[model samples]
Target: MSCSEDPTCQELLDHIYELVDADEDAIDERSRALLAAHAAVCPSCRDAVDAERHVRELLRRCCGESVHAPAALRVRVVSMTTRVRRTE
Candidate 1:
């Protein structure tokens, strides 16, 4: 599909966080395809997604196989996310 027909940059960006938060195989096929199409044409979105994926991989490697944060950290992260979302 052409870039014009693909999801917009913001749409792809919204999915990138979800993509980064989950295993690739766990994401819905449509979202994966949308993100892939957007990333193929938009260098900035591609770089952003790539960076997010890189960070996720690095965290997985460093945190070991299970790859989960502590409860306190999760709480703080969620609180921060909520605050950011509220502002947005």
Candidate 2:
């Protein structure tokens, strides 16, 4: 599906992160095109991209490395995974 067809915010956010983090020259043509297309029209997602970039820069300046995900998020992910697995 085209990027426009991807209705989920998480997909757009993931694409934005990939665009910011991946080497442009190393990315495949299709992926690059998809990111470009998505960023062109999605202002909210673009703001998210900008925010992520700013955070990364701040982390680099202050901590010299990216911060780890919060413990709460990790715990939530583990709990969700266990719940899903038990239902299977």
Candidate 3:
């Protein structure tokens, strides 16, 4: 699943966010390979990863040591998911 096989890199970039949220072992080999390959070839993706980490650190420092979505946002997300599921 190298980025070479998918030059757009969109899918791999999306999976990188998934990897951030996923448990350690939940990132499968293909995703890891794609990420590694993208990092090797794409400075932009590498910088994105670094920037995401830095933002997390900044939030932790600025927001009293932890970061979380607002309750209103969480409720909205849940409601939206329920609506989408019902539509499906």
Q: What residue pairs clash in candidate 3, if any at all?
A: none
Candidate structures ordered by lDDT, highest first: 1, 2, 3
lDDT of 1: 0.67
Candidate 2 stretches with Cα past 4 Å from truth are 1-8, 23-27, 65-88
* Predicted candidate 3 versus true structure: per-residue lDDT over 1-88, tens digit per residue: 3436543456556665454454457677666666767766887666555544454454567776646757475446445554654588
Best by lDDT: 1
The estimated TM-scores of all candidates read 0.57, 0.53, 0.51
lDDT of 1 at 64: 75
lDDT digits (tens) for residues 1-88 of candidate 1: 2346577878776677666665566667776777787788898787677666655565577887667667476446555554664588
Give, for candidate 1, the lowest lDDT window spanning 10 residues.
74-83
After superposing candidate 3, which stretches have Cα over 4 Å from the reference? 1-8, 20-22, 64-66, 69-88
What's the candidate order when arranged by decreasing TM-score? 1, 2, 3
Scored against the true structure, residue 60 in model 2 reaches a CA lDDT of: 65
